[model samples]
Target: MQRIRLDAAAAANAEDAEVWRWFSGLLEERRVRWRYMFSRWVVNVDRVHVATEQNFYDAIRMAKEAATRRGLGLSTIGCSRIR
Candidate 1:
């Protein structure tokens, strides 16, 4: 995995900052660099764009956990569906 795009609707609320923080921590764990851009409509919604690698599955689990904790929607959150 060379990238991960977090779904904005997954955590669309002011109370979700903890989830964002956890997601940031996961990025650090994978040593993946990321850029975030706020999506239109809801200001609480944004994407966490990450750059990772093939062996990043270990971090994927943690990232998923963070996403889930942050109210990740059923929508795709993987790299393949990013673009």
Candidate 2:
């Protein structure tokens, strides 16, 4: 996955920064190379090797699930390929 759009409601929360920090940390712990852009509303994940698309999607799913488990309500609007 190259880009992910975060949920608007979650992005506007007062504790958004902390949530982002935790999310990014979780991604790192899972060995996913990603960074925030456009004021943290967008996440850019580094390119994955060919034929590893499932792994990338799994990482995203796990992160989203973890966030939801923590009551964060995190959601991705979309994910795009880098080309």
Highest lDDT, which number? 2
TM-score for each of the candidates: 0.27, 0.25
> Over the stretch 1-83, how does candidate 1's per-residue lDDT look in tens digits?
22323444444544356545555654444533432334211111125422232344323434455446666422433436535
| CA RMSD (A), model 2 | 15.9
Model 2: lDDT of residue 44: 31
Instruction: Please report, in order, the local distance difference test score of every candidate based on alpha carbons.
Output: 0.40, 0.43
Candidate 1 least-lDDT 10 residues: 37-46
lDDT of 2 by residue, 1-83 (tens): 22333555555564555555655664654533433333332223323311112344444545454545554433332546477
Off by over 4 Å in 1: 1-46, 49-55, 76-83
